[model samples]
Target: MSQLTGPVPDTVFPRLGWVDDLVVPALREAVGALPAAEARVAGYHRGWTEADGAPVESTPRRGKAVRPALTLLSALAVGGSARDALPGAVAVELVHDFTLLHDDVIDGDALRRHRPAAWSVFGTSAAVLAGDALLVAAMRAVSDVPCRSAAAVAELVGALMELVEGQSADVAFEEAPAVSVPQYLGMAGGKTGSLMGCACALGGVLAGADGERVGGLREFGRRLGVAFQCADDVLGIWGRSRRSGKPVGSDLAARKKSLPVVAALAGEGAAARELRALYASPHPLAEQEVVVARELVERAGGREAAEEEARRQLAEALRALSYARPSADVYRQLQEIAWAMVRRDA
Candidate 1:
């Protein structure tokens, strides 16, 4: 459980660079090759143009496409042709975008990838419809996988259900009087971890890996997902406003029951008391109070605890990769990517 205490390192997967080049083209083609029904649905869902003369590109600007890369790479790692996994790649990317579109609307977020969010540019109704369209498109894309693998499609659907359930819990927790560490973990596992697991599982499935190997990759993805969320929690608190493209302590101000706050509430003595007071108070937290609240959570060992949990999850992910018995090179590359994920500055 080594701590990634400094700057993130370069990717271990050299092939990942090559995959990056292929991904955008593959995604574009996958979308383009869809049946007219699916294509129209996706275009409408993305809000590419309005009925009026005005045009707005609701398509989210290009993202890193990390999830799809993982799916394609996992397929290659397990001895399958990356080309065979293209539909899975397209399906997962569409699902991710769908979630983002809905999430932006739910969170009332204005910015995404440095541009106005879909909900901000189009109305919330349009954004919601777009998200729905993307989701349907994902299913359509997966259905086109040449082998007609029912298991892979079922796994993807299960992951989507888990995602929705997890999101439900997240919204519920915000309204709860208090949230425990376990509850927070459960929400994160559902909302974030499941999709990553699906990516890896889909890869293994496409490669025709044995059950044990597929299970191992699934666990690896799940652990990495948890670590990813913990890292996000860390950023939500201590990240610089300019660097994160949001105001610092924004989570605290929203009174969201994130992990750090949960840990402080569950810890020993005065720091815990002060946090409770802050949570209980109706008055807006002043700038200095926000700083003090962060320090209090750290002093209460909440920050350390969260970091430890992240490390634990990362170690578990590495161990799962061992079970997959990947090539030493591939394993090391995955480990490097995992480390970079936790250590990323943005």
Candidate 2:
């Protein structure tokens, strides 16, 4: 395994090109193992081809591939080669996409990565099967790892279980009358935190880090994951509005109990009261109502609360990194990456 970069550079997306070089090729190979029908849907979802399975002449659609970055960085952090953790990186990325596929279906989201979701392109059943296939591929991909394969499999399976639990709780919260801050954090932990934790832990395992060190890395990633979600919830509402002054997104439109909304509803202000009433209404909010809800959340202090929580979680993530006792260079890279999770604009 070759070291991709000597240190973090001026580019905002550090090592993303390295991720593309390693993970994308491996992912393409994994997806090729699927049957043609399932492969077509998976390929389309990954932005590799058209719906009909033709190669994309233009730019291929892709997400940030952040999970794989964490995996590789964690290996480096624990004194292992980035290339040694490629299996873990590939596994985590596959699992991440699996969740996205199912989430789009569960959320009734037609668009993903700024285009039609797999469920929309192929029927719901086909999309689901493709996601399922991807998951199996993920498990298979990691099971062959030369380093601590059993432990790696255990980490991946544990994260999958947590993800399912979080997703179930998220769906249930849609109809629940009240969602406590603790409850929401727990959900976010299961839904998003677990995989990130696994990503980091798997890297440590591949690096042959001790149990204590692996545990620290996992904690760091878990806390960072929650912070990431907090930032994401806030961005979902206000990222675009930073320039336009209009908070908008599908999360608000669907009234998902995201961190910001839950934080706001927990407030005692008049804006919070109005927000509660609006959420309790049987009728779905109109487009204008979405804007009102965004404002109400801000005025009620939900946005501030979420932002505060994000900072606190970021601190905890950094603290956990300290416990892992990485080299100073690794610490700087990990710290920068964790901060980036909360500081992203999109």
TM-score of each: 0.87, 0.93
Best by lDDT: 2
Worst 10 residues of 1 by lDDT: 45-54
- Clash totals, every prediction: 0, 0
Off by over 4 Å in 2: 1-10, 60-63, 241-247
**Per-residue alpha-carbon lDDT of candidate 2 for residues 178-285, written as tens digits (9 for 90 to 100):** 999999999999998999999999989888899998999999999999988887788778775321112456677888888889999999989999999999877767
> In candidate 2, what residue range of length 10 has the lowest lDDT sum?
1-10
Q: Per-residue lDDT tens digits of candidate 1, residues 1-346?
A: 3443344444444446666566667655655565544444344434443434235555433435667777776777787777787778778888987898798899886765445666776678777776777788788778777774787799799999999999999999877888889998999888889998888878888788888888888888888988888877777787643222455587777777777788888887888888888878766677788888899888887777788888888889889877877777667767777887776654
Candidate 2 colliding pairs: none
Q: Which candidate is the best by TM-score?
A: 2
Cα deviation in Å at residue 72, candidate 2? 0.7
